[model samples]
Structure formats: structure tokens, C-alpha cells
Target: MGTKPPSPWDRHPSRSRPERAHRERPTDSNASMHADHKRELRLYGLNAVRAVFARRPEAIRKVYLNEARIPQLQALLKWCAVHRIGYRVVEDADLQKLAASSHHEGVVADVLREPAQSLLTWLQALSSDRHCALWLDGVGNPHNLGAILRSAAHFGVAAILLPQHSSLALSGAAARVAEGGAEAVPFVQLGESVEAIAQLHAAGFALAATVVAGGEDVFAAELPRRLVYVLGAEGEGMDRGLAADCDLRLSIVGSGAVESLNVASATAVLLAEWSRRGA
Candidate 1:
């Protein structure tokens, strides 16, 4: 399928760096305290900003910037102005204090944690015609999450669900790497992977686990129209109970020259196969 047109929010031109996108939060009593109750988090990069703005704007309370970084923050500021979001220019040192892991890249947006939803509710809402979902468990690397989302959107997978206790937010790098795939696909965070899998099975979804050992050969296995593909983290695969719960454990046939495929790469291969089977 051809790439979908750019989202309305993505029409802005790229300057020195991508602009951040985000929504606003109220400054009143209960709301302010709620925002404060959560740790003040900082997010850099354009797409991460966009995800916050597009998905949960109220969680974003402030945007800190520097005059020299004006171009990098133009679009985001414009978005804030139009949406009545709060912002101010602060010192680079202040930006440093707010952002934890990486360079603030001349911008940092204060945001509340992105909320997670149930896998069951998300799945139940999909049309019967749209029945495939990518279920990720313990796959914490943001890059891997973004890549898998990109593949899921590319293959028209119905939705992508991550365990609630696991890493589910679209991190800075993941957002950039997703190239807006984060917006195209619906996302959910589950309370427990094992329970979610069991519920999915009960709902008639044929659970397929990507595995390294004995299981059905992915390419040769006939897949059900309604399917959920479970992918585990790097090195270790899914836990025993979860693996056994799946309707089918699948391996991507290889020469064994390598022990196994990267979790993200394996997901891509499996999702592509499911899409192909539908075709």
C-alpha cells in the first residue's frame, strides 16, 4: 500500500530541527495538583511533541525553549498559540534540569504520563474486517517499539497493544523513527500480558507467538482471519505460561546461522506473513 498522506499537523516545514507539538493543561486547583502529582517529565523532538498534542494535550503543561532554538520550536509554538497551550523561553541550564536522558535539542515540553487503555476494550472496538493486532510484551527498547509500529501500519494491522507495566509511550526516538506511524495505528496498554492473551483467545483470536524453538513454521502455517501476534523482548522470549497459552508458537525458518531474529525484525516478518495470507 502507498504511504498515507502526511497528517494535518505534519504540514509545517522542517527548520534547524523539527518543532515539538503538544496540548495544554489547566492551571486550576485539582488539575494543577494532578499534573504536579506526577513527576514533571520532559520530552524532546517533534513527533514526541505531536503525540502528546494529538493524543493527550491536557497532560502537557509547559514548553521551555531558548531564543537561539526559535526555528526548532516554531511549529510547536504556533500549535500552542492556536490551542492556547502554555509556554515560555527559559535558560539552557533550566532546560538541562528538566530533561533527563539526552540533550534537550533546544526544546523540552513538560507533560504528564500518557494514559494507557485496556487491550480487551481496544480489540472489541475494531471492525470484524479489521481483526489483526500486534501484541508486544517486555519489548522495552523504544527503537524496537517504533519499528514494530511502522511495520504494523505498513501492513494494515488493526492495532498495537503493549503491556501496561511495560514501556508503552512513544519515546522521543521511537516517535521520530515511527515517522508518524504512531498516529496511524491505534495503541493500547494492558494490565497483564498473560490475562490479555487468554482473553484474546477466548474472544476467538488465534494467538501466534514468535518463538526460537519448536513451533509451527510461520510461512507454512495457515493463519486465522482474526489473529494476534505476540512478540517477546530481546534475548529472552515470552515467559513459559504465556508461550503455552498461544494457539500456535511460530518460528521464522532460518539456517540457524544466527540463533534468532531480533524481536522487532521477527515481528516485521510475522506481521507481513499475516498480511500476505489475507491477500
Candidate 2:
């Protein structure tokens, strides 16, 4: 048969993807924090802000958009007006300042961040036997995180499990890149890795460590009914100890031209395979 057509999960092998106009760096400084003791998040881009308005209108504290975007955001503006929420029509410069990014796409909003769910709470609420989640070991890039969230939402992933003390919270750039997926998936904070692993096992989840090489082919392996794909940091890869503790190790068999796919791309491929297997 001829080469199969590329699916949505397919990515070009070239590493020439265009970089964003600005980098969204994470910081604990006060300048990075939003209102209400940093409980709020500044979400920019049309889809990011619009998703917040559509899903949780009351959480939107303020909105700033250019005059040109008014027609597109009529419903959001009307909702703001009805709720007495402050919204301003300003120049693109002002919008950039408000969003702290040049790629704000003419709109921005400050919305209260949804609190993370406890692992036990999420586990208790999981009603489906066939479900998948991502246990992000050290994946910290906001854009990558956003891409993962988008894929997770597309594949019906149950949650993004964050390890205790992991500084990887959703950023504005991540949310913007997610394109409304941020509202669809929930993030669960995990406790100790040992305890978390045990809890996941008890909840009928098999933790599979995604490795660069020397692991079972993910495409051919029998996936668990309930699974958690453990993804690691970009450069360092997964912690050796954690990988050893995992129930199984899996690798995405790719052309050897490159070392491996980025965490986000790999996640999409893995999730697609898992979803294809009817997980």
C-alpha cells in the first residue's frame, strides 16, 4: 500500500517550526502574579479568553480588547456588560501591555484560576473503566504543556497529574496555545511518587514510562484499560528511578534521523495509539 496520509497527530520531521513572537517565562515574582494574591490568571488570545467566558463567565474579572475584535466578541462583551464586569476597548499597544505578549490576538482577560483537584478526589470521580491520563514527571515548557493539553482534550484524557512541588502550572501562553482545551481538561496534583503510584495502581491504572529507546513498541503493545503515560522533562528525560518503578516502559518507534520526538508530539502519537486501541 502507498504511504498512509498524515493524521492530525502527525508532525513534520524538520525542527524548523517558527518560534513565537515572545517567550512566556515563568516566575514567582509579584509582577507575574495576577490579582487576588495571584489566584487569577491573565489569559490572552481569542480562544483562550472566549473559552473562559463560555465556561465560567463569573470568573472573568476584566477583559481588554481592540475595537476590531468587538464584532467577534459581541457575546462576551454583552455578558460582561450584563454582569457589570469591566471591559476596555484599547489600542493594540495597550493589549500587548495587558497580555504581556505581542501575540495577544487583540483580546485578553483576567480570570480566576481553577483550583487543582486532589488525586483521591479525581480518582473517586472517575467513572469510566477505559480512561487515560498523563503523569507529567518534569515536562515544564508552557507551549509543550499547552499542546499536550490540547491532545489530552482531543483524546478524552482523564487528567494531567502534576507531582508534588512541581512548578508546572498553566501559563497564559499555554492556555492560548491550547485553544479552549484548557477549559476541557482538569489538572490533578499528585503527592509522593511512591504513594501516587500506589494510588494509581489501586485505582486500576498502569503507569507506563515513555522512554526514548529500548522499550516495547507503543503501537504494538497491549495497552492497559486504564493507563497513565509518564512523560518527563525535555532535555533530561525521565528520572531513572521513576522509570524503573513504572509498570512498563514504552517507546515510540520513529525514524532514527532524529533522536526522539518532543514531549508534546510524542504524547499526541502515544495518545492516538492508545485511543486507537480503544482504551
Candidate 3:
């Protein structure tokens, strides 16, 4: 039997980082944040910035890199030129203040925001046969969000759904922890869980709520083709009403010592299992 040849990405594991492509600076501009670009957030670190450059160069509104990192960020600067995006070099100290931390790896960006679609519009848009997305009920820690997104992208989950009122938002810390997953995966804001779950049911997704008990072992059962894995914060777990709305409840089996897994950790496990089941 002949199988299709895999794409370069299929062969290249998602964990590997691409080395920076070098180039020279062209006409430059200041690194000031504009009111029009208020929607844009600053992203830092080499991998995170590189991911933005690779995935969507147009999103980058401005570039600020340390003078010493000029060579390392040449590709980004050249991109700024070709894209007519503005950029400027700053001392490493300026970078610290701009990034509000010393972990920026001498690079930051005012990445533009894409207009968000309504939840109905988003659900209408996903007409694919197999649909898998992560829904957060109350999870808001940026680092955990990033970790979940990293795993979600790695295993080919379609999107990350956050409630509109959730405290989660795109920040440099989250983007940096995602290590480019932020650029790779789609993020959507959902409204009330009841309303959203009803729409999901109409869309034909198997709503599986991850819980401490009253759920099946994902490793043992066959997952549906179209599934929505609803997970929540470590302590609170999913909202009771939301959990009741799910078609199935799923749990990860462990050694029975710890009461539960962190939301991000459990998400990675479930996503891995979802892929393993060939869903």
C-alpha cells in the first residue's frame, strides 16, 4: 500500500525551533506604540518573535531589538522593510523597559490584531469533518494558557475557546511560554457556556468534559471524530452547569496519589490521547 508522502512539517517535529534567518536593515522608524496599534501586544523572545515572523509577518506592527541582536534579527528587519513595517534598534536596557522584563532575548514587537468573529460565525466556519477544540471555563493563568496552547498546536487541535468574561488575555508572558504556538493556533472567545454548548451540539461535536470522576478513561475508549474537550482551572474544574451539558465526561487515570492534574497537564494528556485514537 502506498501512503502519501508527508509534508516537511510532518517530518519536522513541532518542538524544534527554526534558526533566525539574517538580513540587513533598511529605512527605520521609532518603537513608540501608536493609539491605532493599541490592539497590538508586545511579544518577546527569539522563538516567539520568530514564530510571528514565520506565521504572519503582517501582524507585526513594529520591531524593537537590542543593538547587539541586530545580526540575529536581520530577517525580521528585512521583513519589516518588504512589508513596509517600521522598526528601530534600542539599547538592551531599553528592551528591558519595553518588555517590562529581562527575558525578552533582545526583541519585542507590536503585533497587529486580527478582527474577531462572532462565536456563531466561528462555529459556522468550521465545516471540516473532524473538529477538536479546547474550551476553558475559568482557566486564566497566562502561563498555563500558553502551555495548553503549545500542546494544542503540537497535536493539531483546531482552536482554543475562552469565555468572553474570562480573565485570560494575550500577554508577552503567555506568548513567550507558548513559544510560537500563539501564532500557530487560532484563539476564539465564546459567550455563555450554555448557549455555546447548544451551538456546539448543533455543529455535531462530541462534548467531552474532563473531570475527576464519573468519566471514562480516554486511553480505553474510542474518541469521536468531532470532539470538544472542555477543561477548566486546576482547583475549580468545570462549572457544574457546563459539565452537565456535555455528552460525555472523560478523565485521565493516574496513580491515585494526587487528587487531580493541572488543567494544562491534563489538556496535553487528553489532546495526546485524542490524536492517539486517530481522531
Candidate 4:
């Protein structure tokens, strides 16, 4: 008999299936890179996604989803339909890679906001509002900043200001922690928080800072007509210049066993007390 023709699968002795690209391989790396370069972040988490929809629906360039996340995706789609926002479906792995972490929970949002602007202009615009501001002197960590932001929004602060070079803008990690507050609150970037405090002083706002030593007790200090509380970095506290600019250096009184409080914790205490003063 003539040699049997080889089956397609068995045709090549050493041939094997080509490795498939992972489902999460980013097809839009260039696009994502552009977003990163522009200081925009790819965000996930249900609340974070909801916040973006509620606050800046137009800011979202796209929304990606996986089959597993369809329930949440449906809700988002409903909202997007109402708002006229566009979105797409993708594999779960793609979202994980886009988020750059596994915490994405199968949903990712491409955010676009006006490039960060000076806190001064925002402060100037809010010049007439009867509200307070929080100046993060040098809080370097995004978690601390995001936590503080959540507290700020809940307590009704007008805005939160950070130093220009302090760290990245509201990141995905921050958005996750803030639980939607990140979008609700306006984050302003300033040249130097110390210099910003000076302008705040000139603008007739009371500037209070947290210090471990030689500062008035937070409970005892008389908050001003308009208040701006300055909380230092978690480890370094406030810079000397920033500390000096404060109208009053206030300290949260706690058990002496602990050397100091986390900057975010200190801020929550001060904001709570300040809010209580209003009530």
C-alpha cells in the first residue's frame, strides 16, 4: 500500500502548538502609557468605578470588563447609558494587567481629568466659600493621602492641597481607599505647602499645624473664622518653614506611650473637632 497521508495534527514530528498570548496581555499598552505620562490612573473597585461615574463620567476614556464582573458591569452600563458614556467588554485577565495588580476585581476605568492645577487658583476660586481646607505638608504615601481625603470629604472640607512634588496625583490605590471620596473632593497641587500657607494667611484663613512639641493642644486651640489645618508627614511631621507659617501649632493629645500619631489619624481628629465646633 502507498504510505498513508499524515493527519494534520501529526504532520510534523516536532511541531507543537504556538504559545497563546495571555488573555491579560495589554493590547493598549501605548494608550495606557500615555495616560500614565499624563498623570491619569487606571482605576478599579466597584465604589471607585461608581465614584468616577457619579463625579466625572465624561472623564472616563473607556471602561473594560470581564464576564465574571457582568453584574457590576451591568449597573455601570445602565449608568453609562443614562450619561451617554461608552464602554467595552474584555477578558478578566486584561483588566488585571491594566490595573497593574490583581486587586482590580475585573473592572478598570481609564480616567482623564484636566492636568493637575495649582491649589492657589482653586483656593482663589473658593475665596468666597464658607469652608475649610486641609494642607498635607509632606505626607508622601498615597494611602495616607487617600485616607485623609476620605475623612475630608465625609467631614465637609472645601478642598485638600498637596505640594507639587510630594507624590503622584490621586492614584488607583488612593481611589480604592478613598471609597469614592477622591472624585468628590478637589485635589490641588501647590508649589510649596509652606508658601501656600502664607497666601492662606494673607487671605485671612487660620492656619493650624500638628506638632509633637511646643504646640497648643488641639482641643484647647481657638480655631479661626476660616480654618486651614496643616498635618505633617507621618514620620517627619511638618517641614520647619511650613510649621513656622502656621498661625497656631496644635498637637493632638494622646497617651504618652506613643511617640506620635499617623498623619491621617491626626487629621481626622482635628477635622472632627473642627466639625464639632460648627455644630
Candidate 5:
């Protein structure tokens, strides 16, 4: 008889018999670590870490730093030791790994994530007639958010309002960029846009939609004593329906060389004008 044809299974034994290859499943410790990571926020940068320690030292779960940072962080380390919090004095490479960024500034802290406050609670607490807040309609860039927080803190903004279903959350990179402003500003989670608008109206606050063009000049306009500037995301801009519902619309009126200032830069100008008027 002619040589028997080789079976296809013989040519691909590994595929035919999958059980021959052993795959290791994640251990319980690995799974637990992942769950812990989800519950914690990795705050890096010297100022960012210091701010968390200053504001909520109890929230800090652990810390990692290079030897060079020890002198500057002696107080923090002492607090950590006293509280029995875990800390590691590792090399630069380990610090980078823990921070997930090279800009860790030689220190990193794992702390419990600060939860956003409800709109109703925040509104109830706002007794000041001369107060300002930001309604970030869709500004999701971390760097932009950080810059905005820094400006907001500098201008004494009351809060940062997040719309329903907003993906914006404080992150390590954003906190680092904020340079401790993250600790100064509180994020308020909003409900439905229309309902939230009504609530603000009831609280004697006016909403101003920031547009690229076809709006009152921000410099000359009479901004409300209690106002919320609705800033949109880059490129796509704010929702048209939301913009239409705003009490007023304002434009920065910059030189036509570029379309407009960055959202963060525009916020600084707007806040400055408001502060100047209130001053």
C-alpha cells in the first residue's frame, strides 16, 4: 500500500490537543491587588502628594519614594510611620513604575479616591451670593482639567460641576499638573442637564454658555454675581441644546490669528474678569 496520508492533527499537534499547554491563572493575591488598585488613586508629584497629606492624611494607604526625597518628606514619613501606613524607599525605576509616569517628582502616594458630592448638597452649602463655578459640559482632557482646576482655585471658584454621565475624574497626571489645586476644589456631580439648570436657576445662579463666536463679549458683558460658565470640549464644542438653554452666551473675542484660546486659558480670562468686577 502507498504511504498513508499524514493526519492534519499530526501537523498541528499543539492546536489539536490544547490541554498540552498549561496556562497559569491569576492567583488570589493578584486579583486582590487589582481590586485595591481600582479603589485607590495613585497621586504622584511632591506637591500633589503633600496636598493629600495636608488635606486628608487618613486617606493615604501607602507611599513610595526615592532616597533623595526622604529629606524633604521627613515629616510625611514620620506621620506614615506613626500611623502604621506602608511605605517603601525604592529606587527611581520602582518609583516610576508605581507612579506609572516619569514625572512622579520622586514621590508617590496611594490614597482613597475622593468621591464627588451631590448637586443638591453642594447647592445647599453655597450661601455666598458672589460665587462662581464651572460646568464642564464635555471637557475631558486630563491636562486641561488640571489647568482649569488650578485657575479655578486661584480665582476662588466654588466648585467644578460635572454633568450626568461625565467621564471626568481626578487622575494622577491631572493632580500632578494641578500642583495641589486638586485638594482645594471640590467636584459636584450634576443630574439631568435641564433639571440641573432649573436647580441652579432656583439657587439664583445664571448659566453662561461659552461659544467661539456670535455671543456677547466677555469683557463688556455684565456677568451674574452667582454664575456657572458652561465650558465645552475642544473641537466639537458644547452641546447645542445645552448651549441654547443657558441664560446667556459669552465669547472671549480673541484675535483671529487662532480660533480661540484654549479652554483652560479662556477660563482664566473669564474668572479674572469676574474677580475684577466683584473686586
Candidate 6:
């Protein structure tokens, strides 16, 4: 007699169970590539997700919420329902998996990143005699960008500029760090330094390159009324050619034993001083 049909659970050498769809991981290389190309990010943490919803709900594509935080996110949920944005009540583990991080405080959002416009186009449209902008040169850290944006927003910076190939593209981490400045600031993409310098000069913006030395002390220098401050990466500062084209190369003076401050901290000090002078 044929043996009882092999049970579905029975481990057979020839038969294997189909993989569960839910088990797919975002950590896979292909998934990471997709995230980069799609300009999408999974933002985690209640405050982070809440801030996006409060500031730019339209940016939110979908939300995966932990069941436990339903009460806290009521307003957001109501808005999602009204907007027809899909949301799912998920287990904490599911959220952790989606974020690929343990820091998710019970919420995750898949949001659309607003594409940055060219500086030439955006600059022409924006008419201002006195405005401040930040240019990041090789400063690819998301957290630093977020911090700079926070300071920029507080001090009324009008725009953020980056090179055509800058790696510091907007990300959820930066947005979360900004605490909402991401919605307030307009990021502008610029071509090479020479072209950008000419364009800024034509637009009547004085460029200031921040450095550790060989420049006027930020406290003593007279900052420009319409200025663009360029900061560099963690170890390597601004390129020499870029500095040469800048109208002013300024240095922040500090008495700390450390050689230099981090980019974010330096940005706060500089923006504060500039704002204080009404520049």
C-alpha cells in the first residue's frame, strides 16, 4: 500500500516548502540598490515619522506602525486615512526588520524624497538681496547634513547647495536630524566649482569657505550680507581650488584642546555668529 501521502510538514529530500514573502530582508544588496535608485527611505522613530507627517504628509508614501503606538499616532493615522495613504499595523519585529535598525521607536515610513533643483534655476526664481546658503563639499554624513539644516533653518538660510555629484543626498536620517528643517530648506544642485562660483557671483552671492586656518577669524571677519558658506567632509576639508574662488575664507576660533570641531558643531557656531551680525 502506498504510504500515507507525505504530510505537508514532512521533510522530504525532493520537496521543499516555499519561502515566506515576509522574510525578505532590506539588507540585501539588491534591496539597498533599489532604495538608492528609487529615492526612497524607511524613516523610523515616532518623532521622526511624526515630524514628516506634520510638516509634509504628502511626502509619505506608506507607513508601517507598531500596534503598540496606535494611540500616540492617532492624528497621523487619521490624516493617512483621509489621504488614502496606506498604513499597516505591524509587530515591532516587522518594523525593526523594515528599518534594519533597532532604534525604530515603533514607527517607520517609506517616503518620497523631493528632487533637488539646479542652482541656476532655483536662484533665478528666488529674489533676495540678503540670504544665506550652505554648500557641502564631500560632507556625506547624513547626521551632519541634518544638523547643518537644523542650524540653517533656525538662522534663516535660504538654500542648501551641493556639487553635481555630492553623496550627501537627502535621506531620512538627515530629515530626522533636522527635526523638520528638511521641509523648510530647498536643496540646489550645482555643477563644477568654477561654473558654480561664476553663477553665484552673477547672482550676487559672496562665497565663504570655512577652514581650520589661513583665514580671518569668524568672530572678527565681516561676513557677507548674501553669503554661501562651504564646509567639507570629516577629515578632508574644502578643495584648494574651491577655496581660491570663494570671496572669503574664514576660520572658526576655539580654545578647546581638540584640534577642530565636528562639521555640525562648527556649522552651528558659524551660522550663529553670522546671524548675530545680521549677515
* Best candidate (score: lDDT): 5
The alpha-carbon lDDT assigned to residue 194 of candidate 5 equals 87
- Residue runs of model 2 more than 4 Å from their true location after superposition: 1-37
Error of 5 at 169 (Å): 0.6
Please estimate how well model 3 matches the true structure, expressed as its whole-model Cα lDDT: 0.78
lDDT for model 1: 0.71
- Clashing pairs in model 6, backbone N/Cα/C closer than 3 A: none
Per-residue alpha-carbon lDDT of candidate 3 for residues 1-279, written as tens digits (9 for 90 to 100):
122222232344551232243354423332233334567888988888999888788788777776677767677776666665656666888888888988888888878765555578788778766768888888888889889878988988887787768766778988888888887778788887778877878888888989987689888866889899989776878788778888888999898999878988999999988887773
| RMSD of candidates 1 onward, in order | 8.2, 12.3, 11.0, 10.6, 14.0, 9.8
Question: On lDDT, who's better, 2 or 5?
Answer: 5
Per-model TM-score versus the true fold: 0.71, 0.86, 0.82, 0.78, 0.87, 0.82
lDDT of 4 by residue, 1-279 (tens): 122222222343332232243556456885675556475567887788888877777777556666666665565665655554445556777777778777776778877754655866876677565578887777778788779879998999988877767764778877877888887778778785557767777777888877887788878888886888877777877788767867888888878998877888877888899888888
> Residue 203 CA error for candidate 1 (Å)?
3.0
The sequence of per-residue lDDT tens digits that candidate 2 reaches over residues 1-279 is 122222211232232222233345645553444245378889999988988888999899777778788878888877776666667667999888877899999998888999999999999999967999999989999999999999998999999999898999999999999999999999999998899999999999999999999999998898999999999999999889999999989999988999999999999999999999992
Candidate 6 residue-wise lDDT, 190-242, digit = tens = 99878888989888889999998777999999887888898888898888888
> How many clashes does each candidate structure show, in the order listed?
1, 0, 0, 1, 0, 0
Q: Total clashes, candidate 6?
A: 0
Model 5 misplacement above 4 A: 1-36
lDDT of 5 by residue, 159-190 (tens): 99999999999999999999999999999999
Candidate numbers, best lDDT first, in rank order: 5, 2, 6, 3, 4, 1
